[model samples]
Target chain A: MSYLQLSLYSETLRLETNVQVILAADPAASPCLLLLHGASDNDTIWARWTSIERYANRYGISVVMPGAHLSAFADMRRGPAYETFLMRELPEFLHRHLGLPTARELNLIAGLSMGGYGALRLGLRHPERFSAIGCFSSGNLLVATGFIPGTSDPYGWISLVMGEDINNPALAGNPDFDLFEILAALHADAPLPRVYMACGRDDFLLNCSRMTAERLAAHPALPFYYEESHGAHDWNFWDRYVKHFLDWYTDTEKTLTETTTD
Target chain B: MANIIFHSLSPALHTQRRLRVILPDSRRNDTNLPWLLLLHGAGADGSRWLRMTRAEYYAEAKGIALVLPDGDNGYYTDMRHGYKYYTYLSEDVEADVLRNFPSLSRDPQRRYVAGFEIGGFGALKYALDFPDHFRAAGSFAGGLDPQSLDPDYCVLTFGSYKQAWQAENDLFNRLRTALTDDTRLPDLYISRREQDYLYTVPDRDFASDNAMTSGHTIKVSRFDFNSADPWSFADRSLAWFLDRICPDRAQLFTPPAAADCPDDCHTDCSDDSLADCPTGKPTKE
Candidate 1:
């Protein structure tokens, strides 16, 4: 459960950035978790707010936490190349620099709030890279208009990211802002990531999680697990559900998908 | 400057150890930039270096990478009754660091080791035992002679005093064996706070061996600075260390020297004793 706070140069951003990397003992053989943080925090928040280390230590999985700032982990129409950094450059850096495993079956992507949206987006967009996806109280970009209370931007800050042409891809290989659009784009028979979504009963983003769950229910071919618990858009709920997600994730094993590593 | 702290399980000790690395932004692009591994004292861990000194400030200006690892109370050795820390450092931690920062130089001449107090002993011992691993070694108030160290430390670390273990761990003995080869030896930089007698003059044998070892650089300096604050002295020790290993780096920041203090008589820092001092404390290094 040892962690390293690294400030490395990001070639994609053309600037130096920081990432908190926590690896289980014998990381070479352990599975990896790309843990993301909420909008209001940086890379250190997860470890600062919860006993993620203790939990990951018990589960024997390595965790990598990166700061996505305010972006929706997308190749922002008006922002930096976060999607390129997170989806491609980051994992490549981990595998090349830290020697952490990079196989699809050996990786899990999870996050909360805006970060939950990030996990769901990246995991869904690149199912070839991860085995399971854990998202808690995800911010539903399924919106057409109006504000999502918890975020700084009213109509999702996502509009700013997607720009005027929401359907137009900002970066090559980037999916459209709408989660339904990304899902519809995915072939049903294509290998899907094992998905887990949980939301607090009192959470503002409960609708986001619910809508996603309902949509997944329609796609019975997708291995999705949904749950609503006595909890909100808070750390207490996330603290508990994150552990629950890890438990569910570890308990169920996914078949190895098509191979891709750099 | 970037502060990178990492933890990894040590197969040698069967436990986890923490290490902090300070890399200068200028050297971030240089794949073969020099590196220095600094060890901490008995009670403190790797973070103490940052807490006690502005190490990153100097590292940034000097264009050299600094590494600090928690040696714990084992004195950076494979303890007779405790963990195999030496093996953990040599076999496990070093390799992990290289992988984490591929920009660091793998050449032994570009690598360095130094320590504070007990860490000073560890630094010299490492340089001695693994001459091909470091280019230079430094010691600040080094416990060079373990027999002269606290009896408790001796028993806890080696199980007895004046025994073969003491002789085996002696820096003088190591200097003889490890420095015999002129071709594969790291230069030495030894310093002490003038009041702290942790390192007196080296014994005759050590002096003779160092004199005969004409192929390498060896320097000794004593600075009158406050040890309680640690950085008051450690900051200077770092500069002097660089002065030997990388002279160009030593020129980056030159602290106020003896000439800066006209009444430089306050070796011990205290209210009444400070009456003899101009700045009301030991001279700032």
Candidate 2:
């Protein structure tokens, strides 16, 4: 993999930010995967916890990881315009700077936690741009009515993503703010991006993925791929399943390398 | 200008390398900007060009891309017992940089490389060996005779001072071979200060000797400044190279000019060996 640590000025964010791009053997021939990180992690986090470089090399795919800070991959009501950066500026920047192919067929997205929600938000909203979505252990997303999904106050911090009105941002009408709305509102004449949802059975945020997967499966137009096993809300689970997600995305016959690594 | 630090695992040198690139801020969409491969000398990392001189500003002013690579004390060579730095710098660096910025010019006429001490020799070797790849190269206060260099550095880098790498790194011999074989040599810019010790005091008159070879077409251009400070060579040479390559742009390589400085600005830099000056610290390059 030809790894590049890139720092460029973002017109949308109005600041300079870092992006990590790893290219497979030939970027001109590989599909571009927009891999996002969780709230506590930056662009360089995934490779540190997973053998993403070797995985990219073996699978013959290019991975682009961008730092979204604690933005939850959303253009916060009070924070930097990260949603604009990721949706509008990011693809254009990658296409111009790295000469990445910009056609919808060559583009895909996936993430873990906040990034997982980001993958669903960015990928589901624009079926014209992305062809596949992978969401892993997305958190605190109960329904479109109340996005802050939790039994108690343990997950209250997720409210910071939506400045005021954390309990109910009146997002049901928008259908673009929360994961369930986006999954529910996805409408296309043709099913383009296949959706993959996964979580650890022992993970605290397992219900989010389950509910979202259920909503996506009931959509009648979307192909749903869901999986769960023994694990917790940690990198080991993500490290193991990210490979499986890649296998399902590439339409490869499932291999038992997961058992070996786990 | 934008400073980009590119970190990569190099298979050629078998090490993790963090190389920097100075990309022009304007005319970025043109995609045909001239490229300059700048190598750092011994006793320095890649930042020597940035910390010691305003090379990036010069590059921006000239609308050229400056590629700065770390040429360790091994003199940018594929050392016998050390790393294959030359291969990494010349081959992998080119690929890595182009991979990152695919818009940079690939034309040989728009490509060049230069350096200060061991870096200068490295540039010379690069240009001579692969003239088809580079249109020009420059050496500032370096690559004189190789024997005039520190014995310890020479022995540690290349087995012996007298014999090892003598034929390979000898610029004079390589130039003769290029001329004899009609290899279509690149334009050369060689220079050294009059009060300099490593180059001017040696038996070779590198500038005049080069003048004799490239008179008709003005291929070998020499512009040795009047400063006595060896520390000032990289700054002056970097400006000269940029001005020579992109003459149309405003010349930002120089300040008010060395002539405008105090008479004793570089007076203490005439020591035969690297040493501390009466007025300042030791020169790193």
Candidate 3:
């Protein structure tokens, strides 16, 4: 495996940011997976906590892990323009510099926690960009704009990421920001990216995942899969399910060799 | 700005290690710039310092080289049952970084360590364990007491929460002994959010103990924030770091360089062929 730590100047975010790229040995013909990290996390979590490198090498695929910080994968109201950087600039950099494929058939996106929300949001908004999208313990489908009963301010933490405009009618219904609205706006005939969703039964965000699955299921033309397992909203769950999701996404013939030992 | 580098055959962990090194853009040739070993929290790696905070921007003018290395959820310890991250941080990583970056200062007085959460614990532990190697240490919302950690995580890290494990790994126990002999110890800076669920009690205890200790060098700063804001912690930590480590320095006050838009423009360039433009601009020919 070859790991490349790239420090690229992000025009969208207007800063020099870090991206961790892991390439399978002899990756000339390998596909690429754009792995997104959760809130307060950078690209390193995937490499540190998960068996991402081994999996990438086993599947002969490359992984691009970008650091979006607390931007929640959104073009932040108060911070960096992460949405534009991740959705556009990063992919372009990979395709140009590393000779990775830019076509939807060879590109995939998956993430856990806040990154799960980002993967789904980016994939749905730019459906033509990726072949499939996997979300683990995602809260993107949850409606979080209103006030919590005990919190001092009703808007709560969601207001930090989505902004106070989340209450505005036009922004509230905007398909680009809301998953349900995005599902509603999807044309029946429009080619949709394959969707895979999973959450731990014990995860706080399990209901959010279920809601997302329900919405995805409503679209008969969309190819969607959902799974629930015994786990929590932790790295253990992500480590297990990320492997499963990758197995489902990749060709079975090229699966990790059974002889390979950890 | 940021340089991604790898160290193969790391003796401490028996694995290849990757780190992101952020150096002052203007001090490439200077060999004695102050160094800060920035550690990442649980489930994070070397990229977090550069990615999650304006650390690189803050360090750029201060002429400090920020070294961020992968800790692999090891809690920055020589885990009783897991990886030896403590050795990696103190011996392997420090040696590797110095070997690679000659411009970074070699003096212990010019080197510092800081981190957030678990990384913060690592920083405190590193400074305590290797008092002669670092001049100052800062912990932002650190998990100071290993016994207070989640049982499952504690078990994985310390083999068992047995008396022996606590004796060997607990920060409080180490501090109690180290505080008696203050010679060579790094000046400690600990900050926590007012509402932090995990570190409030321990932080307060540490602060009180430091206050009671004669010839005290520890400084505890508390901030008010709903839940925890890493950005606020980072901002305060940088200010604290500058005040104690390089006080009243004119260069440290310089603002970050303006966004170089030319490098950013190629991200959204319309031409599909130009999408791979390496120069951050469209190909003219």
Interface RMSD of 2: 18.0
lDDT of 2 by residue, B112-187 (tens): 9888877888888888788888878887766555676667555545657766547777777666555544467777
Extract clashing residue pairs from model 2. Answer: A131-A193
Candidate 3 lDDT, tens digit per residue, A225-255? 8999888888888887888888888737545
> Which run of 10 residues does model 1 chain A get worst, by summed lDDT?
A253-262
lDDT ranking, high to low? 1, 3, 2
Cα error, residue B232 of model 3, in Å, equals 30
State TM-scores per candidate.
Answer: 0.49, 0.48, 0.50
DockQ of all predictions against the true structure, Cα-based: 0.02, 0.02, 0.02
Ranking by TM-score: 3, 1, 2
The 10 consecutive residues of candidate 2 chain B with the worst lDDT sum are: B268-277
- Recovery fraction of native interface contacts for candidate 2: 0.00
Candidate 3's C-alpha runs over 4 A off are A25-28, A144-157, A165-174, A251-262, B1-285
Better of 1 and 3 by lDDT: 1
Docking tier of model 2: it is incorrect
